[model samples]
Target chain A: MKLTILGCYAATPRSFTNPTSQVLEVKNHLFLIDCGEGTQMQLRRNKIKFSKIRHIFISHLHGDHFYGLVGLISTFRLLNREKELHVYGPKGIKEIITLQLKLANSWTNFPLLFHELNSKEPQLLFEDSAVMVKTIPLKHRIYTNGFLFQEKPGERKLLINEAVKYNIDVSLYNSLKKGKDVVSEDGELIENHLVTADPPPPKSYAFCSDTVFDPDIVPQIKHVNALYHESTFLESEMDLAFPTKHSTAKQAATIAKLASVKKLILGHYSTRYTDINLFRQEAETIFPNVDLADDGAEIIVE
Target chain B: MKLTILGCYAATPRSFTNPTSQVLEVKNHLFLIDCGEGTQMQLRRNKIKFSKIRHIFISHLHGDHFYGLVGLISTFRLLNREKELHVYGPKGIKEIITLQLKLANSWTNFPLLFHELNSKEPQLLFEDSAVMVKTIPLKHRIYTNGFLFQEKPGERKLLINEAVKYNIDVSLYNSLKKGKDVVSEDGELIENHLVTADPPPPKSYAFCSDTVFDPDIVPQIKHVNALYHESTFLESEMDLAFPTKHSTAKQAATIAKLASVKKLILGHYSTRYTDINLFRQEAETIFPNVDLADDGAEIIVE
Candidate 1:
C-alpha cells in the first residue's frame, strides 16, 4: 500500500500551505480522501493521473475538507469522462454538489454515484475481492468518519522445487496453492504444506483526521500497519485542543501507542505553526515510530 | 483607475494557469470582479489586502467565474471579519451560497448582502460619491453581465496661484473649487473658468468577458478609457467561437475598435494556446493600443 499526501494543513488554504487532502493507493485502487480547495492542482503538481481516482471519500462538510469537490467533478465533465465515479461522504454532500451542477447546467455525462454516510458505528463502507474499507467513527465538532483500508489475505505461495521433488503434476499446482494435498503419480500421498509455503501477511492502513483525542477508536484501528492521525497542535496548545475538538501531537501519539500501530504518520498541522518538525518531535517523545506528513510525501506500507 | 488581473485563462484552472478573475481598483474601492477557483490564494499572491475588498462582482454562475467565492467568504468568517460584504451576481447566486452555508452550519458573523441580477438591459449595480458601476449586458451561453466602472468627475482644481493673483479670499477658495463664481470683497464678479480649469476627464473601464461577438454592448462601454474583452480563441478557431459563445482575438479587437476605447486589454485565453503573444499579435493587427492580460499583470488607466 502506498499513500501520497496532497495537502496536510488545516483550515484555509494559503499560497504555500493547502488544506486536508490525500491520495491512497491500495490493491490497485486510488482513493481520494478529503478533497480540500486546490486539490486538482495538487494532483497535477504531484503528477498523479486524475483518471486513477475512482472513489472519493469526504470526512465532513467543512469547507476545508470538501470545498474542491464540486470543481473537480465539473472538470471531469469538461474532460468528457466516461468512467463511473463513486463519492462517499456526509449526508448533505450529494445535494451540495448536484445543486452547483444544476446551476451551471453542466451535469456529468458519466455515472456519478453518491453514498451518503450517516452511520455512527464502524460500518463497512466498501469491499472488493482484494481489499475492504471500513469507517472509523471519530469525535469532532461535526459528524465525521475516518477510513480503514485493509488488504485481503492472499493465496499460499507455490514451492515449485518441492512440488517437483514430490513428482506432483503441474496441473495440480493450483490445488496445492489452495492448501490442498495432491496424490502423486507413484500412488504416494503428498501433503500440501510440504509443497507450498505461507503467503506474505496482509497489510492495512488507517486514516484519522480532524478529530479529538478519543481512545475509544483505538479498538477499531488496533494493530494496523500504519496509522495517519491529525496533529493540529503541539503539547503546549493542549489547552485549545479539546475546546476545538482537535488533537495535539502528544494526543495522537498516545492513540497510536494504544492501538499498537506499526507506524504513526502525523498530519493536518495548523497553519499557525510554521515548523512541522515540532509535531514530529512531540509525537516521537510518546511514540518512537513517528513520521511527519508533508505535501507530496509518499509513504509505503511495509 | 487601476486593474489587476488575478487570472486570465479560460475554462478550468490548471497547475500553472488559472481561470477568469480580476481586481479593479477605482476611486479607492477595491472591486473584485469574477472570483474563479483559487482566487483567495491569488489575492494573497498579488499582495492584495483582503479586508479592503468590500464588494465582489460575479459575471455568471459558471464554476470558473464564481467557484472560489464561497471559500473566500468562509475564510472571512474564520478571520472574524466584522465588516459587511456585498456580493452582486446572477439571480440564483444567493440560494447557491446560502444553501452551502446552511449545510455546513457555518453562518457568517458579518452581514452578507446579495444583489441578484436577471436583467437583459444594462442596469446600475453600485454607486457612491466618487464612483459608479453599471452592468454591460452580453450575449453568452448563459445569463451573464460584465461590469463598467466609471470614476465620477472630481471637483475642479483650485488653481491656488491664479486664485491668489485674483485677490480671492482664502475662505472663498472652496467655492472656486466647486466651479462657483465668487464675489470679491469689493463686490466684483470673479469668473469660475478664470480660477479653475476643467477637472481631469472622467476615466472609465469596461470589463467584458465570456461573451460572444456581440456589438450591442458597444454603446454601453463606448469611448471608455480602457476595455478588457475576452479573446478565448484565435482567428484559426473562429468557427468554434460562436458555438462556444466566446470571441476570437480578432473579433475582440473589432469590438474594441468599434467602441473607440483608448486601450484594449485582451484576456481569457484558451489553455490550448501555450504562447499568449499570439493573441496580442492577432489583436494588435486591428487595434494598435492592445495589451495582453496575464495573471498578476497590473494595468493603470491614464
Candidate 2:
C-alpha cells in the first residue's frame, strides 16, 4: 500500500501551500480523500492517472475538504469518461451537485452514484471483494464521519507440495483452500489447516479530520497500519483548537498514542505559520512514529 | 482601464495551461471574470490584493469557468474579510455555496450578495457612478451570457480660465458642464459650446466567450474600445467549432470586422494545438487589430 499527500495546509489555498486532499493506493485500488481546490492540478503534477480513481470519500463538506468535487465531476464528463464513478459523502451532497448541473445545463454521460451517510453511529458504508470501508463516528461541530479502510482477508494459499503427496483430488483443493475439511474418496479425512497456509495479513488505514480531541473514536480505529488525523494547530494555539473544532499536533499525537496505530500522519496545518518543522517536532515528542505530511509527498506502506 | 488574463485556454486545466478567467481593473475597481481553478494562485503571482476585489462575474456554470469560486469565498472568510462581496452569475449559485457553508457549520462573517440571472433578453446587471455592465446574450450549449462594461458618459469639463473670463456663476457652471445653454445673471445668453469643451469619449469593453459563430451579437457590442471573444479553434477546425458551440479565430475576427471594434482579443484555444501564434495569424488575416490572449498577459487601454 502507498499514500500520496496532495495538499496538507489548513484554511485555504495559497501559491506555496494548498488545502486538504490525498490519494491512497492499495491492492490495485485508488481511493481519493478530501478533495480540496486545485486537487486536479496536483493529481496531474504527481502523474497519477485520472481513470484509476473509481471511488471518492469525503470526510465533510468544508470548502477545503471537498469543494473540488463538482469541478472534478465536470471534468470527467468533458473528457468523455464511460466508467461509472461512486461517491460516498455526507447527506445533501447529491442535491448540491444536481443544482449546479441544472444551472450549467450539462450532465454526465457516465453513471454517477452517491452514497450519503446520515447516521451518527459507526456503520459499514462500502464493501467489495477486496476491501471494506466502515464509518468511524467522530465528534465534530457538524454531521461528520471518518472512514476506515480495511483490506478484507483473502483466500488461504494451498500447500501444493503437501497436497500432492497426499494424493488429494484437485477439485477438493478448492474446498480446502476455503478453510473447510474435505473427505477423500478413500474415506480419509484431510484437515483444512494442514492442506492450506495462512493468507497475507490484512492492512488497514483510517482517515479523520476536522474533529476535536475526542478519544471516543479510539475503539473504532484501534491498531490500524496508518492513521491520518488533522492537526490544524500547534501547542501554542491549543486554545483556538477546541473552540473551532480543530486539533493540535500534540492532541493528535495523544490520540495516536492511545489508539496504538503503527504510524501517525499529521496534516492540515494553519497557514499562519510560515514553516512546518514545528508540527513534526511537536507531534514526534508524544508519538515516536509520527510523520508530518508535505504537499506532493508520497509514503510507502510495506 | 487595464485588463489581466489569468487564464485563457479553451478546454480542461492541463499541467501547464489553464482555462478562462481574467481580471479587469477599471475606475479603481477589480472585477474578477470567470474564475477558473488555479485563479487564487494566479492572483498571488500577479500581486493582486484580495481586499480590492468586491465583485465577481461568472459567464457560465461550466467547471472551467467558475469552479474556483467556492474556494475563493472560503479563503476570504478564513482571512477574516469584512468587505461586502457581490457575485453576479446564473441561477443555482446560491445552492452550491450554501451547501458548503452548511456542512462546515461556518458561514462568512461578511455579507455575500448574489444576482442570479435567468433572463433571455439583455438586462442591466450592475451600474455605479463610474461603470455600467449589461448582459449580451450569446449562443452556447448552456445558457450563457457575456458582459459589456461601458464607462458612463461623464459631465463635460469647462476650461476654468475660459469660463471665469465670461463671468459665469458657479451654479451656471453646472449647466455648462451638462452641455446646456444657460442665461447669465445679466440676462446674456451663454452658448454651452463656447464655455466648455467636449469630454473625452467614454471607453467601453465587451467580453463574449464560450459561444459559436452566430454574428448576431455584433450589434450589441459594435464600435467598442476593446472586445474579447473566445476563439477555441483555428480555421482548419471550423467544422468542429460549430457543433461544439465554440468559435474559430477567423470566425471571431469576422464578428470584429463587421462590428468595427477598436481592438479585438482572441482566446480559448483548444489543447490539441501546442502553438498559439497561429490563432493570431488567422484572426489578423481578417481584422487589422487582432491580438491573442495568453495567461498573465495584460492589456492597458490608452
Candidate 3:
C-alpha cells in the first residue's frame, strides 16, 4: 500500500502550500481523500492519473477539505468521462455539489453517485472481495468522519510439492487453497493444512483529521498499520487548538501512543508555523515512530 | 488604470496554466473579476492586497469562471475580514454561494452582498464619485455578462501655475478645478479654461470573456481605452469555437476592430495551443493594436 499527499496545510491555500487532499492506493485501488482547492492541479503536478480516482472520501464540509470537489466534477464532465464516480461525504455534500451543477446548467453525462454520511457511529462504508472501508466517527466542530481502509485476508497459499505428496489431485488444489479437507483418489481424507500454508498478513490504514483530541477514536483505529492524524498546532498553541477544535502535535502523538499504531503520519499543519520539524521533535518525545506529511510526500506502508 | 492577469487560460487549470481570473485596479479601487480556481494563490503571487478588493465581478457560472470565489470568500472569514464584500453575477449565484456557506456553517463575519443579474440589456451595476461599472450582455451557452469599468470624468485639473498667473485666489482654486469661472481677488473675472486644463481623459476597460463572436457587444464597448476579449481558439478551429460558444483570435480581433477599441487584449487561450503568440499574430492582422494576456502579465492603460 502507498499513500501520496497532495496537500497538507490548514486554513487557506497559499502560493507555496495547499490545503488538505491526498491519494491512498491499496490493492490496485486509488481512493481520493479530502479534495481541497487546487487538488486537480496537485494531482497533475504529482503525475497521478485522474482516471484512477474512482472513489472520493470527504471528512467534513469545510472549504479547505472539500471546496475543490465541484470543480473536479465539472472537469470530469468536460473531459467526457463515462465512468460512474462515487462520492462519500457529509449529509449536505450532495446538495452543495448538485446546486452548483444546476446553476451552471452543465450536468454530467456520466453517472454521478453521492453517498451522504451523517452517522455518529462507526459504520461500514464499502466492501469488496479484496478490501473493505468503514467510518471512524470523529469529534469536530461539525459533523465529520474519518475513513478506515483495510485489505481483506486472502486465501491460503498452495504448497504444490506438499499437495502432490499428499496425493491430492490437481483439480482439487482450488479446494485445498480454500482450507477445506479433500478426499484423495484412494478414498483417504487429507487435511487442508498439510497441503497449504498461510498467506501474507493484510495491511490497513486509518485516516483521521480536522478533529480534536478525542480518545474515543483510539479504540476504533487501534493497532492499524498506519494512522494519519491532524496536527494543526504545536503544544505551545494548546490554547488555540482546543477552542478551534483542533489537535496539537503532542496530542496527536499521545493518541498514536495509546492506539499503538505502527506509524503516525502528521498533517494538516497550520501555515503560521514556519518550522514543521518542531512537530516531529515534539511528537517523537511520546511516539517513537512519527512522520511529517508534506505536500507531494509519499509513504509506503510496510 | 492598471489590469493584472492572474489567470487567462481557458478550460481546466493545469500545473502551469490557470483558468479565468484577473485583478483590475481603477480609480484607487481594486476589483477582482472572474475568480477561477487557485485565484487566491494567484492574488498572493501577484502581490495584490486582499483588503483592497471590495467588489468581485463574475462573468458567468461556468466552473472555470467562478469556482474560486467561494474559497476566497471563506478565506476572508478565516483571515478575520471586517469589510463588506459585494459580488455581482448571474441570478443563481446567490443560491450557489449561500448553500455552501450554510453547509459548512462558516458564515462570514463581514457582510456579503450578492447582486444577481438576468437582464438581456445593459444595466448599471455600481457607481461612485470616481468610477462606474455596467454590464454588457453577451451570447454564450449560459446567461453571461461582460463588465465595463469606466473612470468617471474627473474634475478639471487645476493648473497651479496658470491659476497663479490668472491671479485666482487660493480659496477659489477648488471652484476652478470644478470647472467654474471665478472672480479673482483683484475683481477680474477669470475663465475656468484659462486657469485649468481638462483632466486626463477618463479611462475605461471592458472585460469580455467566455463568449462566442457576438457583435451585439460592439456598440456597448465601443472605443473603450482597453478591451480584453476571449480568444479561446485559433481561426483553424472555428468549427469548434462556434460549437462550443467560444471565440477564435481572428474573431476577437474582428470585434475589437468593429468596436474601434483603443487597444485590444486577447486572453482565455485554449491550453491545447502551445504557441500563444499565434493569437497575437492573427489578431494583429485585423487590429493594429493587440496585446496577449499572460498569467502574470500586467497592463497599464495610458
Q: Write the per-residue lDDT of candidate 3 for residues B62-112, one digit (tens) a residue.
A: 999999999999999999999999999999899988988988877999999
Q: List model 1 lDDT by residue over A1-302, tens digit each.
A: 88999999998888877888999998889999999988888888989998878999999888999988998999888888999999999998999899888878779999999999999998888999889988999999889999999999978899899899899989999998788999987789999899999988999999998899999999989999999999999989989899999999999999999999999999999898989999999998899999888988999987
The residue-level lDDT of candidate 3 at B158 comes to 90
Clashing pairs in 1: none
Better of 2 and 3 by lDDT: 3
lDDT of 2 by residue, B7-126 (tens): 998768876677788999987789999888878877887788867899998888887888888888888898889999999888877777877677677899899999998898888988
Q: DockQ for each of the predicted structures, in order?
A: 0.77, 0.62, 0.83
Model 3 lDDT, residue A105, Cα: 82
Q: Indicate which candidate wins on lDDT.
A: 3
Tally clashing residue pairs in candidate 2.
0
Error of 3 at A163 (Å): 4.7
Q: Give the top-scoring candidate (DockQ).
A: 3
TM-score of chain A of 2: 0.93
Docking class of 2: medium
In candidate 1, stretches whose alpha carbon ends up further than 4 angstroms from where it belongs are A184-187
Comparing 1 and 3 by DockQ, which wins?
A: 3
Q: Please provide, for model 3 over A169-278, each residue's C-alpha lDDT reduced to its tens digit, 9 standing for 90 to 100.
A: 88998998788999988789998888899988898999999899999898888999999999999999999999889999999999999999999999999998999999
The reply for model 3, stretches above 4 Å from the true place, is: A160-170, A181-190
